[model samples]
Target: MPDPQSLDECVSIQQWLQREHLPLASPRPPAAVHVSLYCVGKSARIPEGVIAAARQAGTAIEACQFELVFDHIITFLLPQDNAIVLAGNGGRELWQLHVQIAIEMHRLGADANLNPNFQPHTTLLYDKDVVPRIALRRPVVLAAREFVLLHNRRGQADYEELGRWPLHARG
Candidate 1:
């Protein structure tokens, strides 16, 4: 998850899109803005043991804080709706951290289906209308100081934070 300032910046971008008369769907709360690392499973299917394992996996990860630079806003076409997002490369450190987390999860007997082609992004809103990619005037840089494990119910806006772990400062 991003820091409070970054979350505010994301919300500001969403507000900008709304002002442009873009066909935006629901606006996500600032607290809900996040770059998803792994999806365990559905809310009902995820057992307490799995959650514990996930938490343990998080604790096992050894990584330094990194920055994520979102340079463009793009739309991903989905069957239900188009997801408008702030897209970024998220650099090598982020990828390494992601892989480390996945490795730890697997070691702890948890299913962390790591995707080879993972694109880091933060979804701003959803819409039926597709929009062309727009480069930001200034790239939004988010300091990824910490990561959280969340339990999000489908079709709901609220996110239940299961656990949080801080990335240590680089030496």
Candidate 2:
């Protein structure tokens, strides 16, 4: 997830979408902005074991803080609505972090359903209208110093952070 300031900048982009009269799929606060790393499945009630495994995965990964550069804006057509997002190259460091997390989750007997081909992005908003891909004049860069495990309450637009782990500087 992005730091607070970067999250605010993401929110500003969403605000721009609103000003342009685009019908927002939902109202999301700055805190909701995040690039998803793994999905731990969706159930009415999440088991304690699953949460434990996620935390364990967070602790197991040894990586340094990295930068995420979102250089373009694009729209993805979904079954429900079109999602406007900031797409970026998370680079090798990010990919390794993701892979390490997946490895740890699997080793801990958790079903993360890892995607082999992961394209990192942060969704700004969803709308019926499609926005053509546009390269930004200035790419939005986010310092990824930490990762958090969040329990998202579907339809409520609420995320409960369960655990947070900081990425230390590599020796």
* Every model's TM-score: 0.92, 0.90
Clashing residue pair totals per candidate (backbone < 3 A): 0, 0
Which lDDT tens digits does candidate 1 get at residues 1-171?
Answer: 877788888999998886784744766777788987777676565898888988998888888988899999888889987888999888998889878888888898888778798889998888888778989998899998988999987777878898999999988
Which candidate leads in lDDT?
A: 1
Q: For model 2, how does the per-residue alpha-carbon lDDT over 1-171 read when each residue is reduced to its tens digit?
A: 887788887887778766774755564667788987777767967899988998888888888988999988888788887778889898988888888888898999988567887878888887788888878777889998888899988776668999999999766
- Counting only residues 3 or more apart in sequence or on different chains, how many pairs clash (N, Cα, C under 3 Å) in candidate 1? 0
Output the lDDT of residue 119, model 2: 78
lDDT of 2 at 130: 84
RMSD in angstroms between candidate 2 and the native structure over all alpha carbons: 1.8
- Give the C-alpha lDDT of model 1: 0.85
Model 2 weakest lDDT span, ten residues long: 20-29
